[model samples]
Target chain A: MFPKMDALGMAGAVPRAPQQERSRVTRARLLEATVECLVEQGWSGTTTTLVATRAGVSRGAQLHHYPTKAALVMAAVAHLADRRATEIRAEAQALPTGPDRLDRVVDMLAAAFTGPLFVAALEVWVAARTDAELRGALVPLEARVGREMHRLTAELLGADERRPGVREAVQATLDLLRGLGVANLLTDDSARRATLLAAWKQQLKGIVNS
Target chain B: MFPKMDALGMAGAVPRAPQQERSRVTRARLLEATVECLVEQGWSGTTTTLVATRAGVSRGAQLHHYPTKAALVMAAVAHLADRRATEIRAEAQALPTGPDRLDRVVDMLAAAFTGPLFVAALEVWVAARTDAELRGALVPLEARVGREMHRLTAELLGADERRPGVREAVQATLDLLRGLGVANLLTDDSARRATLLAAWKQQLKGIVNS
Candidate 1:
């Protein structure tokens, strides 16, 4: 990205827009690699060195992009949240209008909860609780993520705008999915997941019908 | 606990059953301290030195009881699980056989999910996922806890044991509650919790009636 002087040594300094684009691509690759490491190795093992190696970039290039580990990890999470928001938006747009919409929404939401992104985020969230610097950076980002998630969930559910608790219930749905995701970390337990999904579907059907 | 001697302290030279009582008390105190440490300061800040100080025991005495940090944390979690089992049994015994029972049970379960014990256990669970030594010790203990938890949840719900999916749905209730608990870690959103509770109560009522 930076003329490849660091690692990967491709060429010298390039032009403005193209250089920036390459930089963006490199940054995205590093962040994606960070998430992969978090999911596979958890917090303790997700080192900057590991991330650089995973990203297929030189250590110097990684350092040039992210000056610190906390910065790299935080940026990675924010990057992930943004990507998820875009995915949700696209999914919501393409979703068919029908009785089965809620089921599809739940499936999408469940996938969002139980995957590598969620695991990576969970690792950061837990670590940041005790780390003052990390917490300071994460608090605002998590708030933004929460708001977007709540809004998307509300949209997917077609929840009543006039209802006082509809939004809160949507938030609860996300919270419940998060809990199920946490449970899945230890074991896949599909029967438990299916039962939970059925119960969630039943309650949502009640809400929609009401 | 061995008499503060021998780092590899594996010998019958310690003492008899009389020693057992004192050792039990020391071990219990250490475990209690560990939970406190976990709740107050997550995994990273919880050190053996700090735990030994908090438990009002000598470092050597702590080492004598549990040789390693992994062992200490695992034992603390197992101890908490056992204590929770006892509490659940007592709660089950005192529970009334009436229409309000499910409501009361939900309240009790909610308290269980959002408390110091659950937080302590969650810290261990998250840490264990990354730590091989910790995970090896934790898996079996977590299985035992899961069994006890499932058993108690079934008792509280008065779920029919013969129904395959019903019991799993009950487990889902617990999982959802746990997710709510995790959300509460960042913000105490009582309104959302209440809405979820109401929804869950309605669903449970439907189940009971059916």
Candidate 2:
């Protein structure tokens, strides 16, 4: 049940502005709660009603923003992923311009994949496998997120894709980190991951450097 | 709703031997059907009744072998994964032991991950994220499967783990392939995969060849 917009609201008067702001706040709450639910309960367990309860909003208000579970979860993940991607880019700004910059960049990227946002996005990804509607929404969102990560990784590492193996090497790094993220989904693979990362950084330096 | 075994069958006589064989056959059918269901329907959409119907077995027969959905699907994936892992090892025997060995090994391992067995296992994997009981059953199964692949890869690459970066290099290869498989689930990523594989094989050669 949507809130009724009065005659002045219909005419776009300034007095109805607070209603618009309240609606934005409510929508943000729903999206944030959706990501939390996805991370905590997984896609199958997360429901619109539960999200509404978690967000402390009325079920009607939640439905007004996200009519279906698919739309709600997709939008929630996309919104959160964009924020996380931006955070990754922002975090890269402080990195040292030294020989270890690739190492730091790899560490930063690995941290992004192992965090709650990746977990939440992973839930949607698995669900989307059988749900074409979710897949339709997820594919483009993931492409944008993935491309942003790739470009940012290249920027932080200062690698020239014009070099022979540079592009694929960067991709392998992302793929490896993603795989490490998947490994961590089941258990803490940090010990083995540490060894692998150390080894990979040495190898990546060779390909990314010249 | 199990089939009633008569006194002759209860005695475990030679005449009742077909009962044992028939039970094995029925189990194979159910397991095969479960994998098919998982690949086609994903974890959430798959149900025991549906698997039974697909297998052309009575619900009683299916439940007799697997008392719960978790048990059924987990058993299905584990059984198939074992077979597939064996197949990967067997297929390796035909590979030429030459300069291209590493390339073929990576391709073989990547193929294993992109197949229906991996897809089915992936469904259980994601479902297990939310279901503790399923995770309890899956973690050990996956550990065993993962170790097998790792050992096989080490053998195929002839890498001595005593050397620095050798063990981690093998793992990185598996992780990279798994990540590539994840990328392929939603769409065809063969082109990018080919490129990444090319770059990684060259790197792998350096680590594996001592």
Candidate 3:
């Protein structure tokens, strides 16, 4: 059993080390479950109770950490995106550099967008379109994530933003890859996407190298 | 008052000309209203009763034509996309067909995706990711619309798909424009998007022209 909160009814009051570690594991599970629920059930179908059950944490514990569904979902969004950024960097480390570096980096970024995390993020993006409260939470988080991705892409390609068109070329690459991700959602658009990526990689070389 | 359906409970049973015209107008109103509702309320918040009220049609009439929510929404998705394609073609007619044709075409496509129709389609797309029935209705319709757009884009750019990379170049252009549309949904991404489009236009000219 988890330890009780202090008189202030706050979990942030320096709980014992063992309890703190347990709490971290529980929260991570909750966030991961929230993402899975979003991917499986979408924004409307996902609820706090359902997420709690899926996460294997008690409803009370879920509420204690994130009182509202918005808080829980937003936290998951942030967590998922942060994890994805780290994953992209880690994956990039294994890639080879040289003539094929740009192609490999583009493929890695495209793969990042085609997975479950992107699907979860997309559900939030569509839901945020109509919900102002959710939109408010999502906007800043996405901006930060997007900036990090753009910076990472520029670094990976070794392209200098100061060299005219380099910044836009990098951005175009992200946008094109994301669009391919969207296209892949309903159907297996892999064949068309492969062709497009090959073409983009070639044009990307000229822009970044020249 | 509107005419009643035939004994077969079908409106396509050779109704009177005036009644048929009225039905056409009513159907158009309903489809337009559905798109608006999807954009304003999202997929979960959109309902048959709400769409009927918004369209100024009786719920009975709405059901008589499209018995299920999925049917109504799918029709709207197809209708919205069709209208957008038509608008794009009509708008493109006024665009000059000279040196700046490719830039103008790219700009036009980007504008198409940033509008309410695209937002409504996006709402359905996310909803369809988890809803099998909705996905079933959407895939073919989107493919048809996508093909039309691609063909029109190729013609407008005077790009020959017979060329090795021209097809992928055009597809990439669409994907990039669409990704820009997604980026615009949550924030004002015009400045960054403008720069990216400029860079793409230049690269596109080489791929498509060569």
Candidate 4:
């Protein structure tokens, strides 16, 4: 029923508050659905329709929020990066100081690979390689992750960014972890993953001590 | 017109040897063209028609050799791995044993990232993430590369697989290199690249000396 009312009654008549909350909830649902689709179909097959259907919303509503599939994908990527940054910061902080720090960093880094979010990130990366627009959008996220990684490793090693071999080792370690992510995804071997992680920590320790 | 000839003369008339040589040349040309296509258009965009046109061969002839696009991409990836193996072996042998080994390894590893072959391989890797067939074909190649890296690092560090920390560090360094490749492909900062390489070597030194 529609109503004509005075000031206090008119304020209640406005549905803006509930509408805003519903919009926020729908947006979050869509983003989460996008991640699930990425994990299932990768970047190549993650259509907007799939994301909308997964989110239990109509295609029109999905488009109303995201405008385009690229925008949706970009938003999903940012959501993932924010989540990962929090995990990394928390894990890095939990590590014991001195020699034990190396073990903690290695464990945390290795743990990052076992989740679906990282897999989605890899899909985004592959998508970015060919899409200039996606690449442009991804640069800030990549830089932020890289800077965080450098900071985390430096803190763990008790070395500054300028310390000899710190940057190189950090970069190399990130590469190895990325490669391992691909490897772990392709195969079903946990032992090999463990071996790789252990070998990485040893190398990191060597770098820090040297 | 058909020519009537004796059996011995007919055998000579076939020109089998020259035809085989020509086929080999055509195959090589096709592979070179495939690499070019991959570098220009990425794995998803590269097609048999495009590769045939780039190689200046008929589409029929290209298919006669490669049979499928997957076969062509696999061939390109294999050729890349072989070339990298040769370079790594040569670089490793050229370096004097001990601390000098790390420098030589970095130089060779650097070459792997700065070239067309690595770029092509990166495309193959991206393609493999979604295509089960491509992933199946790439597993052995990835394993071979990993083994080669392991062997080279073991030699450089004078550590065996039994030393878990040494192996872990080596693997982590490799991950960093892989991550750096992604970064380098996306960015144009040479100074940052240099810093990454320097840090890698310093990390290696620490691992080796320890």
Candidate 5:
């Protein structure tokens, strides 16, 4: 049980180690639940209560950490970005310097756009467009995610990213992959996605090798 | 003044022509208003009463045509598709059949993605992900729009429609442009968009010319 804030409300209060650990665990659970709700139910169905229920945390605890739903979702977005950055690095380190690595890297980029991570982020992006308070929180977080993704993308491509205009071309490729991800939302057409991926991989080779 | 439905609600009731035309005009206005609202206010701010007022139609008239907001928005998606199809044809004809044509065509495609049409559609798409009835109405309309856009894109490019990989390449270009459009929503960075366009144009030339 949390004591009254007045007990710990001093200007420079320091919580005990056990309390800090409990708070961290509760926050992580809430963020993960938010992602789950977004992917399965989208923005309209994702609420603070639902997130708290799914995380098995009391509403009081949820509100204590994130007073507003926007705060909770914004924190979740930051959490997702951190996970994606770690993912990109892991994928890059796992890949070798050869044609097979290129194929694998391209696949990695494709998955990043179309997989659960992108879907979860997309729900927030859509909701933010209409919600002013959310947009205020999301814009800075989005920029950081974009920068992290760009760096990881370059690392994945290795020497291919060094040439002039290569960055632009690769950026375009990622953008298109995202578009394809959106398209897939309604149609679920794997064949077209595959065809586009093959064509883009070839295009990337031309841009980088040139 | 319209009478209650029970008065003329028999199994096979016939509405007169002038009334039908008036209804048509009212529906068109409402659809157009929905797009304007989406671009300016996004989904959260859009509602039936606001659309009816914006369209200058009576609330009764609005309810008579589309009983639910989902129905109204779904119809708007179809309306948007028709407008895009018309825009593509007009742009293709306005463009000359030469080198400059390719440049203009690419620019036109880029605008189609980043312009009001795409943004309006995006609002509906985002809203639909969480709304089942809306999703059911949206999927078919989206497919029809996708097909119409593809045909016009082939014509705009002035190329054979039967090529093996050409469709994939062109689709990828459109998709990438759309992704750029989404990115622009937050950052509003025209310079980055232009650079991506130039890079994508080169990539397309390689894909199609091959």
Candidate 6:
């Protein structure tokens, strides 16, 4: 009886029937292609044609998924951010709360920023600055990341946003992380990365203790 | 004798060949134009042609001065860095050694990173990552900034580079400053800047005391 022709069975039987699955595949392809193009040609050099060619899709098909380059870039940035957030969150959760939390955060941040996906996303951000439309799309993502940092810091420091030095610590930490991101992109020095991470841990410990 | 050779015969004398003052006017004009274009069109948008147009100079004139877009951007970065180094040095010299030195260093670093010129230079740096040629040219400038930072931190802490945590502190502080530069660019929140600066100072103090 062919497994009772239900939506699940039919969907499984016909691989191309489900719109959601097809959409997911298209989105994945688009993101993978975006990253590839970004790493190969950088943000300024990556074009729709290049992404389409890399993705093995028609330009029209690519457009159907991401109507504009800005849109595609934004999607890529979000994709990267989402993955990083998950990774950081997991690391933060695994660490014991006090000083260890700070270490975990710094290590996680350094690793995340230097990771290939994040590097590609950062390229998009650089590209987005020259693009007003893309910048507009990126603002919310920036805010979201900031908010996450604020939340994480608040949790780690046992202070609210209104606490005397909580805001400063959070901001400084974020800045440190951002600078390290740039450093990683510029230099391939693991020792430098380790030194930076250690310093961040030490600094965060000071902030927490003080 | 014809009234002493027409009153000392000084009438036709070329006015002491006016010491051809090496005017930095052209350089200043280029830097100003670069900033304007960067702010208007971003790093990628500020091409040599666009910068020349903005500076009201011919392409030949621009090339004669800068030669390459990377050269122009790097010149702007160096100009900004020089100004910052001068400002920090002045502030550091004004302070009596002890804790005041550290305070002034932190203050200067915070202020410098958050300033407009630094922000513009950062935008150029983001663009530099994509252009290997520009990145190569700019790395030394970045290293110089880092070296200056390490020197300042060492002096402030009265510690050598080989000191237990001096290198880490220096690296971390620089990373913090870099992150702050990006944060300031992304948002127009003065309050956040002040908070971040205070936190940075406190953190530095803790490290020194520790």
The best candidate by TM-score is 3
Write model 1 residue lDDT over A107-139, tens digit each, in one string: 899988988899999899888866788888988
Q: Write the per-residue lDDT of candidate 4 for residues A30-74, one digit (tens) a residue.
A: 888998998888777899999999999888899999988788987
lDDT of 6 by residue, B46-78 (tens): 789988888777788789889987788888778
State the lDDT of candidate 4 residue by residue for B69-172, as single tens digits: 98998887776566566657765776787667777777677667656777787777767767899899888877877787667756655666465366666665
- Which one wins by lDDT: 4 or 6? 4
- Every model's TM-score: 0.84, 0.90, 0.91, 0.79, 0.88, 0.79
List ranges where model 4 is wrong by over 4 Å.
Answer: A1-16, A88-102, A152-172, A202-210, B1-16, B87-101, B148-170, B206-210
Task: Check candidate 5 and list the clashing pairs.
Answer: A176-B176
Residue-wise lDDT of candidate 2 within B153-199, one digit each (tens)?
89988889898888999999989888888888888889999999998
Better model by TM-score, 2 or 5?
2
Model 1 chain B is weakest, by summed lDDT over 10 consecutive residues, at: B5-14
* Reference-based lDDT, residue B34, model 5: 83
Tens-digit lDDT track for model 3 on A124-167? 88888788999999898888888988998999888988998888
TM-score of candidate 2 versus the correct structure, residues matched by position: 0.90
Poorest 10 consecutive residues of model 5 chain A by lDDT? A4-13
Docking outcome class, model 3:
medium
lDDT of 2 by residue, A1-210 (tens): 755654212323355478897887787788889989988898888999999999999989988889999888877877777677667777788888899888888998888888888888878887888889889988988888789878888888898999899999989999998888888888788889988999999999988886
After superposition, the stretches of candidate 6 with alpha carbons farther than 4 Å from their true spots are A1-17, A90-105, A149-171, A203-210, B1-23, B56-58, B91-101, B153-163
lDDT of 1 by residue, B170-189 (tens): 77678888898877665565
- Candidate 2 chain B: 10-residue stretch with minimal lDDT: B7-16
Model 4 docking tier (incorrect/acceptable/medium/high): acceptable
